[model samples]
Target: MIQYFRFLIISLLFVSCTDETATAEFAKGADVSWLPQMEATGYEFKDEEGNKADVLQLLKDRGMNSVRLRVFVNPSSDPRSGHCSQEETVDLALRAKEMGMDVMINFHYSDSWADPGKQHKPEAWEDLSFKELKEKVYEHTFEVVSAVKAGGVTPKWVQVGNEIPGGMLWPEGSTDNWDQLGQLLNAGYEATKAVDDNIQVIIHVDEGDNNEKFVHFYDNASEQQVKYDIIGLSYYPYWVEKDYTETIDNLAFNLKDMVKRYDKDVMIVEVGGLYDQVENTKNLLEATIKAVRDVPDNRGLGVMYWEPQGEKSWSGYSLSAWQEDGTPSPALDAFKN
Candidate 1:
């Protein structure tokens, strides 16, 4: 009888430790949304040691505990640009899950890149009425999330829309039309909850250093009663400010203030630096990570490098952390510390 009691206590302690460890895992993520497409084009990824390796494994070895993938409603048929469809996202997400990495599903809501400058409504959703558009947002969000769940992996985070600093499903859901934007975002949020009540739903916006923009956006969201769990920001020094130090300082200040103002967790969902400037990139990443870690009450989750594997030859995207031999740049070392 004493032996049985001892075994029960030990088992309970083990379970409790496991739960705490899982909860304490900070998100170190990479947005490899183009990995599948890149691999299809015969691109191979190498580790820092210059040895060929599985991209997902390479990232995991680099201290990346999570991955973010974007999904489009209906993208171009071209294999290169069209692979982010619902099914494709599910497959990629499943792959990440199998590797013991948390997954963040970013819904673009459009067929192509949806950012602050252009929030193009999906081609199929262009003709829908305001009411119909709201319904479409909910349906599409629910369908994609459901498919992801059905694929044997439930994403740890679900971003309702990508880089909607101004708003999404534009003209109708633009920032100026706060009411409609809130309604659309709420629809997406509700759909996500319906699929997985525990999943953290994020609302992403570009310009992490701009406290004013965040304040304006969240204030409006509060007024409209838009429900969400995380505030995702895109902080690119090259685009936001010419001085890297200034950008870092501004971002750190805003991150702290944003959490206090809105009382919500925050994350740098997108960030990148010039691949050629390896040292600078490393410094930028280190500073960014430190700033995020300093957020009060651990509300600052972590930073995600956007498309660090994007080779210029294949994607024409200049911002990458890969060398000519396809190995990750040394700048990635910042993630270790």
Candidate 2:
């Protein structure tokens, strides 16, 4: 009887795949990049008195099953925006996990924002030698991920860097330095693996529909020995001058073609339809939801509307506009497929 019980346990373990494999099925997930704000006191969506809504419940109610969170290596010197600190991120992750949501970690590898136009090096990393910088990257990544895991919320997926086409960590690891870039990313991968081998390492890059640039960027990464599981894309219709239907169609075609060609699963890690009369945010959301549901060959894995509920107005980092009473407009209806 004991032997039979042991066999049953082994079978269960063998059949149950890791979170990475399970999520690869849908490529379906949401990036909850606003946890820092939601946890703050007296914070209301768009500063509306009644906007104290539970975002996680709302997303789950709408059929979202996973959440992605971005971690800045050291965020800004400012105190308020400094909340992506290890303690803050882990706290948010724990809450999400308790609510029965899967999580993904996006490593920006900078103290502040890291993107295509600006991938600045951390202040501390500015003086490090090449070898020292590599070591620091690995150490920092391991510590952050280890803290998240220790906090009882294990992320199934991790992005090495954000929208890094020109490369991240500046000068040394910047675009023209493929050798340095490859070394830096490998360090991040090792850090993630040290936490859990099952975690999927994602190499995220922007410019989804632009076949020429995407292909070129990825081919370069491949040659550099940057090991990763998922290829993440950031698609914004406004940037490409395409309508909602046209954008989704283009995304679907590219996704299917890329998967077939690269033999790698794809995730729209950062995607948003600006609700503020830009890119027809409303129409784009509707189309995106439909696209996700009817994604051809299951390749349209996941689409995360970037910071839909962030502070409104063009003056701040937030997207979207507000009504006189601070009511969030219908731009968010894009998620309601």
Candidate 3:
């Protein structure tokens, strides 16, 4: 009887330790880059029960512990695209910080969207030479990070460029020119560390399920010795048309392998679901969260829903978690886990 009791006690202690370790590690987050703009246009968000609530507070109540905001350098003259300028980004970051949520600042490095297909340099930087543009990247990163710190909110993470699968700063720093791209990335990384050494730097790219793409991008970045802490991926189900089960399994496998290969943490820094497909979207979120959480040795940091509050009329963005009435979709419940 004493031997059996000892075994039981050992099992109980193991379970307790496992629970505590799991609790200490995961983060639930959302990218609400359009929050300020949506609120500016009189959009209101309500809790699941229909009570009017502050969006940030509602998110916190729903178990989201982090928020990601994107910043553009000298945004376009158009009002819609101009609101995410450095000052506005700092203001938003302050708001998120006030709510006791960690903040991640995504630098697009352009006056507009900077993705794989379009990484247009800010108009101001268009005139600079290749060498000069590298300086600009460093200067921009340091300035924005400095401003965020000045606003009394030191971001927990900083993304050097948004979805740079092909690369950023156009032909000058495109993937075709891996050497220049590496220099620009290193510049951003160094600048971010200059402001705050503790801030985790991320290199974001789209197509989370494409393992080869990730391997290719990181292999080049590694070869060029680009410094970064996290591998951020944008995984949209609509973009990856494989069988649902296959897709999730592939993503999970890649996530684990990437962590082992890079020896760095990983995050689904950006993801979105169709507004009308609440149930399906919920499944996707649950699967994605699980995949990230399943990375061995706690290397899976978290997943962030991209623009969960963006409604059709607000920004014409289709992949929001908000219904037409401004109430959060059932898809958001996945974050509650």
The digit string of per-residue lDDT tens for model 2 on 1-337 reads 9999999998888777654465554533466665465445444443235554676765555556678888876666353344476777788888889878888888887877788988888787889899999999899889888999999988888889999988989889887999899999999999999999998888888867777777888788888978888788888876766665666777666676677767777778877655557447666666665555464565556777665545444224333323334445555544544
Rank list by TM-score: 1, 3, 2
Give the winner by TM-score: 1
User: TM-scores for all candidates?
Assistant: 0.94, 0.83, 0.91
Runs in model 2 deviating more than 4 A are 1-29, 38-41, 46-51, 77-82, 289-297, 313-337
Give the alpha carbon lDDT tens digit for every residue of 250-309 in model 1.
899999998888889999999898888999998999989999999977789988999888
Clashing pairs in 3: none
lDDT, candidate 3, 1-337, per-residue tens: 9999999999999999999977654778999888887787788888767777889887777779999998888876454576698988899999999999999999999998888889999999999998899999999999999999999999999999999999999989899999999999999999999999999999998989889999999999999999999999998877666534568887898899889898989999988878888888889889999999989888899999988888777778778888887687878888898
Error of 2 at 99 (Å): 1.9
Q: How far is candidate 3 from the true structure (C-alpha RMSD, Å)?
A: 4.7
Tell me the spans in candidate 3 whose CA falls farther than 4 Å from its real position. 1-24, 77-79
Candidate 1: worst 10 consecutive residues by lDDT? 74-83
Candidate 1 or 2, higher lDDT? 1
lDDT of 3 at 276: 88
lDDT (Cα, 0-100) at 91 in candidate 1: 95
